[model samples]
Structures are given as structure tokens and as C-alpha cells.
Target: MLVSKKIPWVIKYRPRKIDELVNQDDAKALVKAWLRSWESGKPEKKAALFYGPPGSGKTSMVEAICREYGYQLVEMNASDYRRASDIERVAKVASLQKGLFASKRLILLDEVDGVSGVADEGAIEAILDLIETTKNPVVMTANDPWDVRLRPVRDKSLLVEFKRLTKTEVLNLLKKICLNEKLICDEEALKFIAEKSEGDLRSAINDLEAVAEGAGKITLDLVKQILRARDRVLEPFEVVRNILRSNYVWQAKQNASQTDLAPDELMQWINENLPLQITDPEDLWRAYEALSKADVYMGRIVKSGSWDLLAYATELMSAGVALSIVNDVKSKYRWVKYQFPSKIRLMTQTKEARALRDTIAELIGRQVHASKQKVINYVLPYVRIIFDNNPEMAAKIAVGLNLTDSMVRYLTQRNADAVLNYVRELRKAISEEVKASKPSKTSSGTSPPTKGKGKSTQTKEKEGRGLDAFFKKT
Candidate 1:
């Protein structure tokens, strides 16, 4: 039997005009102003970055604006944006204004955060270049624009943040889809789907189509039976809720199997919410005991490289910890607001500073002849003290250690430029002294004790060694 293809509801009912967009009046206004500014020959920012959670209308709004406003849209998805050559070519094509009949172009780079690995830096540079030169209005979309690699683009862009839709917003959109399709949908059924979708309009519409495709009437019971969480990727909160709400062991395990998070990451999530979820002391202890066992399993897996043990670890973490609420079943289903794992949050907050600190440690370690960790633990303290108290001496140490601008900034903070200025002066004085020390050409226009390039290279090496020895003594 052949089944006829039909357009997906998300694609068919996509917002085509400005007013059709659900929320984000602020973002829309900013984008409109930015586009208008481009018309006058120069805008404050050449690009706009739209970032938020999925289905928040970043890409959709861009498309809708182009459709209604008469600008031609040139879109690139995640895969297409990785190649720098391709990005350059597209930017070049966008720069073309061949004739009076040519329409203004809008270039959309969707999912800019997904680029990773060796080519990621190059990809970012390409995007930055594209923003600088492209005559067309350039826009980039990301789910999370705060990714450290995207920082360059974020600085150069007009940041417009979109927010997740409210449940009422999702419900209204679903009702509209139901009305357009002429499918009889109960209010309860629509509400149930909207609540499960958690703010994503595309998911809500897709869920609506899933249930109302063949069924003449959509009811609460039918929606419950067919519209399962397994139909889409569940968020972390949804994953936790589903696991804790499970009646049977397999049901709890089933929920764990659906998420994209790794086992350890999921454990952190469960551990964070367990205390809030369970009030009873005994139950809380039991839940943590199960998490501890899962942690042990993970540690063992890491040490032995026995990946076959992952199922046991996952089982202990998800089903084991979830079913620990045996005594007070009510606590398991309590409406406690879950939190992001605090430990991960702390790590994210400190990552850049930690990386910079380690870089300084490496720079000093190379000079002092020690390991990076050793320098961090034993020597960096003294180096920091010198940087804080003495500018001239710190500059000498910086020159000897061969530290970068960022490294110096890490140590001295607001005083970095003062120390760098001293370093520059020291280098200038050293250059003048070296020039005076060099052998001047003889009266016959012949160099003195010179062996061509070999002597020049040896002389440079000798000067470098002398400076290193001089700094070490100082």
C-alpha cells in the first residue's frame, strides 16, 4: 500500500508575515530597525545574532521578515557553514549588486553553535569576515550564543534574545492548527499536548498532527495513548519527571533511555533534584546511596575501560535512584522545581579563569624547569606577588618567561598595561645597546670577524643566551 505524502504542519503553517510571529516584539523591533539602518548605506552592526531555546522563532522570524519585506533570502544550515571556502563564496555572491533589478539579499547562517573540532576556529573567522564585508544583511541563529567560541561574533553583532513561548501561546497556536485542519480536537487534548511541549510551538503542532492524522476525533485518552514522550527528545526536566513518575522498573528505565545526556551527566541532574524531590531522611539517603553506587560503577568503567558495564551504571543511576522512594511514594511525584546541576554551573563559571591561570603556570614552568601543575602549586604564588608589587621587576620576569598579553593581564589585572609599558621600554633599551655592541663596517667597507649568515645566526643566539642568563641572575 502506498501512502500519499503530505506537508508537515510545522512547515505548512510557518509564520509568513511579521504579525504571525508569536512573541518577541523586542527582537522583531530590533531586527526591523537593523534592516532599515542597512538601507541608509551603513548600520551600527552589520549582523544580528538571534539566540534562545529551540522553536523560539529565531530562524522562522528571519524567513518571515524576508518573505514579507521583499529581500531575497540565502540560507545555510549547520553542515554548509563548516567550510570556510563555502562561507567566503556565499559572502562574495551576496556582495554582488549586478543591476538595478537586483533585490537586496539577506544571508542566514542557522545553528552557528553546532560547529566544532579542528575547523571550528577557521569557521568562526570565516563568519567574522563574512560579517565585516558582506553587503547583504547577515544574520546568525543559535540555541545558545554564549558558547565561548561564538564570543567573537556575539561582540560584533546586535544581540536579540528570543524567549520560550508560554503554555497559553502554545495552546493558542495548536487550536489555530486544529481549526485550519478542520480536525475535531478536545480542549483537554490540546492542553495536554501543550503542557508536554513545554514552550516549543513546532513540537506542539507536530504532536497535534501525530494524534489527529487518521483519528476523526482527538480526545484526552487518545492523545495520552499515542502522544508519548518517546515521540520526541525530552528535556532534562522532562527526563527526570518521567523517570520518577514511573510505576514499573522498565518504565523508569524506558525514560532514561530516551534522553541525549550521558549517564554521568544524567546522574548529576537526578542527584541535584533528589533532595528537593524527596523530603524523608530515609528516602533521601536511599536515593543518594543508589547514586553513589552508580558513581562507583562509572569510576570503575573509567579505570578499566569496561564500557560493557554502562548499562548497570545507567540502571543504578536512573531506575535505582528513582525507585528509592519506596516508603513515601507521594514525595516522588511532588511538584518541586528542578535545578541545573550546581557543580557543572560552578565549573562553567570558572573555566575561562582556570584556563588562563594554567596558561600562566605553563609559561613560568618552562622558564623555571618544572611541571605545569608543580608551578601552579608552588611557584605561581610568588610570581603573582611580584606582578602585584613591582612593575619593573615584573616586566623583567615577563620578558624572561615570554608571557603573552593575556597572561600578563591575568597576573596584573588593571596594572597589565603599566607592566607591559615597562617591558617595552626594557626591550627598546636592550635593542639600542645591542645595536651599539654590533661590529661596525671597517674603513674598507668589510665586516669584522664575520662568517656570513653563520656568524649572524651565532651572534643572535649568543645575545639570546646572554639575556636569559642576565634575567635569571636579576
Candidate 2:
């Protein structure tokens, strides 16, 4: 047995008159007056523009007007024709040619705003000129009317603004169509489509078409699938919630790493949300302490270029952290709001200033043959002055040292600024420290300054050298 495709009720029985159209009662009344003027042997505005959000029935209005006034329609999107000659051809045909059966002609321009730039400019200008003097009743539709380029058209035509359809109007229309077509869809499914449409009837119809095509009846699951296709990637919060709600530590770990977040961001999400999930304060502290150790491992991995360490770090933060929790019962948790890490934000702004300061400090430490730490303590104050003038140098140092935004700010010693200033200061301090600690540099340059006594200088310098040697050994 064969079956014929079922036509949707919305399309099978579209309105043919202004009075029959759903919503836009005011626009219908205004269109009615225009029709009456033509009926009584008087010419109203020869051209009118319909401006509104998509699927608000601008095209439908034009067709209704034609049916009411006994006029044949000539419709086209302005974007399709690229040349001035093409538009002129259309204008000539519409103006000179008689309607196939009716006495009058109705020209409908869809998406008139799309006509623009080098290719369509001539064609668009021609159309506007056609509107100014054309004999037919012209109806133009566009999303926006305040576009400065459309100002001339506004001067030449009457503009009617159509609003987005209300929820009640969309619901009523959907209900009417469903009844007429004998389609069986749950109220929730229909309402879901209507809300998702955002007042766009075409979108609603398309959704209806898809659902009907899949099965005779539409279900809520189908609607959810269609609506949420773009959100496939697992969210970190969902992962954490599932983990905290689970009974087994290994299961929780597996669930947490299933999300799209990397180890670092994942750590922050866990840190912020873990306390809310664990009821016991002692358990929460233990979990946090384990996470902190995992973070230390993560830092080591980054510095030493050892990727094998990531698994250990991840395990510590996930399974280890979860085990630290005393209870494993599932329950609701207060949502942790996402926030930018202050340190990261600062790095972005003051990277350059920080780098330069670090470079200079490293060089000074090398020259003195002393420890990087001693050089930083003694030389950073002087280098900070450079930040007042050379912020980029300071920022560069900050980047090299991996200073957080707050640390950057602390380095600059200025609280009232774009936070970038702080980043620059910190970068300089860190880079200088790294350079001073290099293997080739002697311990003498990094040594600390002494008191008024020459003995103090010698003693501090020797202590600085000892510190540098210790760091090198580590």
C-alpha cells in the first residue's frame, strides 16, 4: 500500500483576506482602508513598505491585498536580481503588462534590505526609482527601516511596522492548524516549538514539518533533540554534580574528566563546587588539601615538561579528592558561579612590563654573580620605576614568570589602575628571577646588599650565593 504526503493545516488553509489574518489587527485595519480607497475609484498610496521581524506575515499581507483588490501578483526577493537592467526589466514588465486575469498589478519586494554594496547597488537604486514612479501598488518588506540608505525609500513610500507575534497568537495559530490537519501532537510539544520559534512562523512551520516527517505524531523528546542539538559537549558543572552525587570514588573521577574542561579549569570548577557537595567541614578541607597537592604536581609537570605527571595530578584531584569526602550520598548543591581567575586576567594586561623587568633583573643578577632571589629583593624596587614609563617591558617579565594578575598588581604596587599595570610589574620580577637562577650565572651577582659595614655586604652576598647553589642543586 502507498501513502500520500500529508500537507500541514497552516499551509493547507492560509488566510486570504486581511480580516482573516491572525494578529496585527491594526495593520489589517490600515490595509482595509487602503483597499476601500481603491474600491471607491480612488488611488491610495501607490507604494507601501512593510517592516518587521521575520515571519510576521508581510508577504501574506501583500497576497491578501491582491486578492481583496482583484490584482495579479509579481513577487521577487531584491537579492535575486543583481543588475540594474534586471530590476528595470521587472519594472517594465509589471508596469506595461496587464495582469493575466485581473485589471491591476501588485509588485511584492521581499528582503529589500539585502540589496547593497558594489554588485547590487545599481539594481537597488533602480528599484527605488521604480517605486517612486511605478504605476502598480508596490509592497516592500525589510527587517529594519532606520537604515540610513533606506531613508530615501521612506520619503517616497508609506511604512507600516509589524511586530513579532505574541505567544497567545502563535499558540492559537498552531492549535487551529493542528485541528484542521488532524495532526496529533502533545500540547507541551507544540508549546515548545512555539516558544522556540521566537515569533517566527516560518521556523515554527519548519519544525512542525520535521517532526511530522519523522513520525505521524510528535513527542517531547523529538522537540528536545531538535532544540538542543547545538549543546552536545558535556558541561563541567554537570560532570562535577554527577561525580559528587555518585557513591564510588573511581566512578566520580571518571565522570569529572568526561567533561570538556582541561585539568586546570577542571581544578577550579572542582575547588569551587566541592565544598558545597561535601557536608562535613573536615572532609571538605581534606579534599581541598589533596586538590592543592594535585595543583602542585600540575605546576611541576608544566615546569619540567613531564606529561606523565598529568594522570597522577588528575587522579589526585578527582578520585583522591572524592575519597577525602566522608559521605557519598547524592543531594542538591548550591550552584557555583563561574568567575575569571584574577591571576589569569592580570597576565593578559601586564605581560610586557613584567617581562622587561625580569630580563633586566636576570642580567643584573648575572653581572653580580649572586642568587636570583637576592637580586629580586634588592633590584625589583628600582625596576618598578621603569613600569611608570615602560609598561610593556614590565609586562614581558610578568609573562615569563607566570605571575597572576593580582601578583602583577602587587609587583607594580598600584591598586588604582587597569590591573594590566600590575601584570607588567609581576612579569618583570619573575623573568629576572628565572635568568638570575640559570646554571651559567655565578652566585656572586645574586647576593644581597649589606649594612653600612662592608662585612654586612660580604656576609649577605655569601648567603645569597649559598641560596643560589641550593636552588641549582634542587
C-alpha lDDT of all candidate models, in order: 0.78, 0.67
Per-residue lDDT for 69 in model 1? 76
Task: Give the per-residue lDDT digits (tens) of candidate 1, residues 71-177.
Answer: 78888876576567777786556655422354788888887775432133467888888888777888888877887778999999999999999999999998888
**Model 1 off-target regions past 4 Å?**
1-5, 96-102, 116-118, 229-297, 300-474
Residue 113 Cα positional deviation in candidate 1, in Å, after optimal superposition: 0.8
Summarize candidate 2's per-residue lDDT along 1-474 as a digit string, tens digits. 133346553455567987777788878877777656656766567667788887888887888888877888888774454466877888657866778888888888776664432123576577777876676777788876776666777777777878899777787787776775578888898898899888978677767766766576777888788656533556776776766554334456667667787787788777777766676676777788889999999899988989999988888888667656543222224454544444555765778766755655664575466677677888777656655556665655444343456555555665325447555454455446656667576555563553222233453444344334334433
Model 1 CA RMSD to the hidden true structure, in angstroms: 28.8
Off by over 4 Å in 2: 1-10, 116-120, 230-474
Clashes of each: 0, 50
**Best-fitting candidate, scored by TM-score:** 1
